[model samples]
Target: MKSNKATIHDIAAKLNITASTVSRALNDNPRISDETKKKVLKVAKQINYQPNHIASALRSGKSRLIGVIVPTANRNFFSSVIRGIEDHANILNYKIIISQSYDEYAKEVLNTEALINARVDGIIASLGKMTENFDHFHKVLDKGIPLVLFDRTADVLDVSHVILDDHLGAYQAVDHLIKNGCRRIVHFTSAQRINIYRERKRGYEDALKANGLEVDPALILYSNMQLEDGRRLTEETLQNKVHFDGIFSSSDYAAMGALQVLKENGIAVPGQVKLVGFGNEPFTSFSDPTITTVDQRSISMGKITAEMFFEILNNKGAELISKKTIIKPELIIRDSSK
Candidate 1:
């Protein structure tokens, strides 16, 4: 009642049971009778008793927690993935701690170190945009924490990854444009440092080449994938007389910006310039002209990423399973593309 803290001893004293018995009941030990466990749980809840996770970790050598790092939680894709992780991890009796990197490499490093210090049994992460150096993850490996990289991954790292096939997704977007008789196409991309972007860029090029169109270096512009970047590039290309009948953007947000600029300049969406984008963001469909884009199956990706973590954990660190799971993306047709 004084409210310093509620402990198991308090619950035991109130219930007139041994602290060990209370502990067992709290843990749902099969040896404890259901009636006793129910009573103990009821009293514990009344007293607002909190378990000593640190002590439990010391006893079992595990925190029964998983650390998750995402580029940005504000984005729908990452948030959906986190939801999937929570749903699956909850079934496994594991709690989760989430951290956002904000697409910064330095912040990612710091967040990971903090997660390791928390004694998390495993980590599920989507690497930041500029994480060229994966030494921090290797440190996670050195500490024997099972790590699974999802969405964005490092090819050089010897870890399991769940990723969408960005190349094929990009090819599909571009090929769809080609099918609609879009000859000259402009590709707006960002963060070429990340493998996903690089793969998407490659797909855009190969699709153009396969369709007997020359890969135009001048048409491809890399930016920060921000709304302003999309607007600026599209505006500049229009002013520079870059004849582009179609525009393919790597992000839906940017595509939305480009769409605005196209409307301001009296350009028809599918009639004059068919447009496509990546990442099936919610705004894609809600926009004036629904955006034709690629769906990365983010929920399924998150589910499998968590499953991969359990796979490594079930092995009990005897072997680091370096498996790669790639999901092929699906193209969603909408009003913006014919």
Candidate 2:
């Protein structure tokens, strides 16, 4: 036969064996004799025969492929999670394709649609900010593909998820500052639409109430939570003569900005203005004064998220589908807050 591609039929033709027998032998079905299997393998090696995975998958109705979505590909938290997911997925002989939403609502929807069109066996994702509409996520469920969310997840979605306890993390952070003698604390957060930040803000408020401190409406500030915003807000608070002994920022980047401003203004961290930041990013450990923050256990969250997807995938028809996993956040004490 005039053919450029090598296939199992070519091996069978050379060995003068039935194609079905050759297939069984190639797969080590145990029905084939060892000697015959050895012979089949030898000829198969000579021809460099490769099994057609596409055809096999089509027959079994499984792509053995997973789709993953995150807010940003370059972020430390998302990258760490990707490593965990990759390690676990590789062991099961499955490949994953990843997409980033850059924390945009529209892009996340588009990415979800693209993954669905690609026909992945399952999906794992972290929701982006401003993603109130979840019809695209529903599309995945309608197609019967396994879906799991991690980190910034949707409360309304009834699928597998692995997430950090944001409320407790924030509560502990504020409580620690209070214990250290911070009375008037300022909170810097992102938009209220995002769930994690919202939860963290709530925790901040609850911690204040629990510590017998009145919730000051003027102290809770919302911004983009960027570096410049952090610095600007700190300066603005000072200019406005807002009396605050502590500041809890929702992001490390913002906290760093605030730290710089505090230093320039002769404010001593953990002495004059105790600062606590969320996200134990790498920079948090090496800053001028190490930052006290919440460790979300992102890598472990990733592994568990993938595990949840596989659990549902492996148990396709079973009713044990919708599962939720909450990863506890640990408080890391450092000079900034201690």
Candidate 3:
């Protein structure tokens, strides 16, 4: 029950013209008259003639495709970043192939190999949570393909990277809390596995030390950046009588968890315990007391990443310079941190 594939020969036969003439017309050849070209195109459309992408790619030596890898496509931040990349790629006549690694190192390796086999002209990647190795990325560099890193990037790779200014964002958040008469502040963060988290923690510590406040080891809580983990940590803090006046969480979801637990324990926000979080996720603004956080400028980062890739592709003589572009994060003040 399969339908036969239509070809240029079918159009040529119907028009009583040669296949070469049909090919030239379809290609918009100057020698072919407009009337003949229009007629050939109309017949081709009627017959549902389709061009082979593989054949065209082989002939031109350009796939006009870009590959993007992210930790999780389901997250709001990553999805927005993908949208930004797609918008820019579409304007430049390029298509994107997206892959998710699920924050696993092995899956990241597999995804990189698949993209290489597909022969993508460029790659944009945000490192997964468990990705600590850079061997897979070197394969793209070995092939002379342009690679751009965004968000969570590899410290070892010497490539173009676009990321938010994590340290300053954290500094501003903590500084604001201090100005609002919050002392004995606590930092709830993850393991120092990535630059963003590490830098944010450092910023928090530095702010406390600068303000002549004692940096209590018991107050710094380390947990997986998850809602359940946040809730568990908050509950533990209450059980142990930690006496924390303020908290700075590295994730909005975690902050939400902390808020719920504190409310259930009859603790007032901003009145008893002020809080701030990172990554101004959508839910931050809609929470009971709107959460204060940092905006990562994800869309602009994606556009700049696409722009960097095309710049390398267009430059014929000059070698592309590997550089890092840091986009500063903006602190969004809300009622939660008041």
Candidate 4:
């Protein structure tokens, strides 16, 4: 059976010109005269001709496609980042391929391999929480592909990245609680080796010491920092009779869980126990007492991350110097802390 789909040769034959000329005209090459391009385009529309991107990519050695790997697309932060990347990519006549790692190391490795095999022009990713080894990302660099890491990044990989000042954000949150007379403030954090968590923990400790308070090991609770984890940890703290006047959680979901546990136990927020959370998730504003939180400026972070990726890509990986862009976090005080 013969396919009826029109090709450049069909348009060339109709215009009494060479197939190469039709191809150049379709691509808007300056070498092709405007009159010839007009004729080729008119016939192309009549025949419903569609350009094959794969064949064009093979000829140019450029796919005009970018690969994006995120831990999870369920979060607003990662989605916003992808939007920023897509918007900029569209302007450059490029398309994006997105993959999710779900914070799993093995999945992240598979995504990296898949993107590389797809022959993407570049890759943008955020390191997964369980990713200890960076050999997969290293492979990308070795293959001479542009790689950019945003948010959760690794120190071992010498790639460009954009992130928030997690330490400063934590410090401000803890310090704000201290200023409001929270003496025994409990800090909720994750035990992951990711730099963000470590920085937040450090900020919490530094804030306590700076306020003439001793760093009590009992006051620091480490967990996965999920909603259930926060609820369980808070319940255990109350049951164990741990005395605390405030709680600072590195995650908004965890903070909400703490709030729910406090309400269930008849504890009053701000009056008895002040509370603060990070990540300014949408629910923070909707929750009863409206949780106080640190805004990560996710939209700005996304745009900056995309811009950085393009900068490195335009440089064609010739300059491998590690560049870091740190965005400032904003503290949003609400009923929970007031």
Candidate 5:
């Protein structure tokens, strides 16, 4: 069917008036007469006219769009963050375009370029695991685009960053275990290359020293912070006959693995070997014996990140300072750690 779509020229020709006059009348300009405004509105509604947002944005020099880059959407933590960003953007009448890097450095660079080419007003990003190079981020900064980093951030970059107090959280977890009659405690951690894992390991070591306990290098097992890696580490710990009465893993999945291994070896959690994990993932509460963990306040982190990005966009002043917002971690006591 031929649609009766109307344009400004069509309205002008039909009313025997100039297109500029029709445009002014439709826009309710004070210079236009009330009779002409009514005539234009009636014809526009009858012909089902609609203004093009792309054309409007071109004239206004603003896209009203933001970009978000994350490692992956599969994890609950990241998904929650995205939801918070989206909610805040909705309130401000801005749209978000998202890209996933799958923890690959090259993919992250590509995604960064894509967002920049799309001309988004600002960007929010979480660095991937294998992302060691941050030159791509500098490009965004050089383009005068506001960027905020969350969760896994690059320390070398001077920009807005939001993350949890990982070191303190780990320290508190280990201290709690020690106070609860755990003398020989082993730490299951991830690769120390990442800042978060390094902080967590340092916290564990600091807690041991504060309690006058000798930090056993042999008790520290580095894993990949995955479920399978955790399971493998647990098996190795059991086979090696590591003399430890408790376990503190850097990830909840790894802690869950240790719990499973302990059960298989007839070791009682809290009764024989206590356990604590990080992230407070949902599965932590549903294990055979619920796992104790530290809550990262991911949702709140997301909301705050979005707010920061919007603030930067609203006031891109010369004195605008970059911020590093650290959200505190909460200790959750469950059956795994008494």
Candidate 6:
């Protein structure tokens, strides 16, 4: 059976020219006249021509494709980061392949292997919560591929990364609550050993001490920082008679959950219990009482992460001396914290 797929040879025959000339025209070789290039492109569209990216990569030793891995894409933060990366990728004529880890270690490892097999020019990734072994990422470096980690990164991994000042962001949130007369505040945070959460917890404690408030272990609640976790923690606090005048959560979803529970129990926000959250998620603004949160500067983080990847690639790994870039966080004030 004969295939109907159009090739450069078919285009050449249609234009009464050699295949080499058609190829050069398609490649926009300076020697090929603009008139010829335009004609070739018109014919290509008419015939539904597709360029062989694999063949081009084989010839040029560059796939011109970037692979990105995220814990999950459902959040606004990760999506915005992807948009920032796309902004630069469009101008550089590079294609991006995005994979979601769903915060599973096995899934993350599989995604990394798959990307490596795809021969991507480079990879940008955020470590999954369950990931403890860095061998999969090490394989990428072992194969001479560039890997750039963003947001949730590991300090042990001797690689380039872009992150926000989690400590400062958390400190700002706690400080804001304290200034608002939240003398006995409840903190919801993650129990994971992840640096971001650890730093955030540190900031929370530091802010309390700075304001001459005692750091009460009973006020600290550890969980996955999900909506259910927040609700359960808040409920337990209410039931156990823990005296808390405010709630500061490390996740917006968690904070929203706490708010719902508080309102259900007839607790007035800012009047009885002030609230603050992190991750400036969209719903924080439109809630009945707006939420005060910290902006992670995700877009800027993404742009810087992509730029660092390119730098490593262009410099042939010379810039991979474990350079880390930290973006500042902004504290967004709203009704919840007022």
Clash count for each candidate, listed in order shown: 0, 0, 0, 0, 0, 0
Give the per-residue lDDT of model 3 (tens digit) for 72-189: 8977888888989999999978999999999899999999999887777788999887877799999888888788899888779988888888888888888888988899787888
The C-alpha lDDT values of all candidates are 0.91, 0.88, 0.86, 0.91, 0.87, 0.91
lDDT accuracy of residue 71 in candidate 6: 90
Q: What is the C-alpha RMSD of each candidate to the true structure, in Å?
A: 1.6, 3.4, 2.7, 2.4, 4.4, 1.8
Candidates ranked, most accurate by TM-score first: 1, 6, 4, 3, 2, 5
Q: Superposing every Cα of model 5 onto the true structure, what RMSD results?
A: 4.4
Off by over 4 Å in 6: 1-5, 18-20, 317-320
After TM-score superposition, the amount by which residue 78's alpha carbon in candidate 5 deviates from its true location, in angstroms, is 1.3
In model 2, where do residues sit more than 4 Å from their true spots?
1-56
How many Å off is the CA of 108 in candidate 3?
Answer: 1.2
Winner by TM-score between candidate 5 and candidate 4: 4
lDDT of 6 by residue, 1-338 (tens): 99888899889999999988998998789999999999999999999999876777777788889999999999999999998887888778888999999989999999999988778899999988888999999899899999899989998778899999999999999999999999999999985578788889999999999999999999999988889999999999999999999998999989999999999999999899999999999999999899999999988888888888888888884644768899999999999989
Give a tens-digit lDDT track for model 4, residues 1-338.
99998999999999899999999998899999999999999999999998876677778878899999998988877888888888888888889999999989999999999988878889999888899999999899998989988889888898889999999999999999999989999999985588888989999999999999999988999988889999999999999999999999999989999999999999999899999999998899999999999998887887788888888888883755879999999999999998
| Model 5 ranges with Cα > 4 A deviation | 1-59
**Model 5 TM-score relative to the real fold:** 0.84
Could you tell me the TM-score of candidate 6? 0.94
Per residue, candidate 1 scores C-alpha lDDT tens digits across 236-286 of 999999899999999987898899999999999988999998999999999
Relative to the unseen true structure, what is the C-alpha lDDT of residue 150 in candidate 4, on a scale of 0 to 100?
A: 88
User: Residue 98 of candidate 6: its Cα lDDT?
Assistant: 95
Off by over 4 Å in 4: 1-19, 33-54
Model 2, CA-based lDDT: 0.88
Of the pair 1 and 5, which is ahead by TM-score?
A: 1
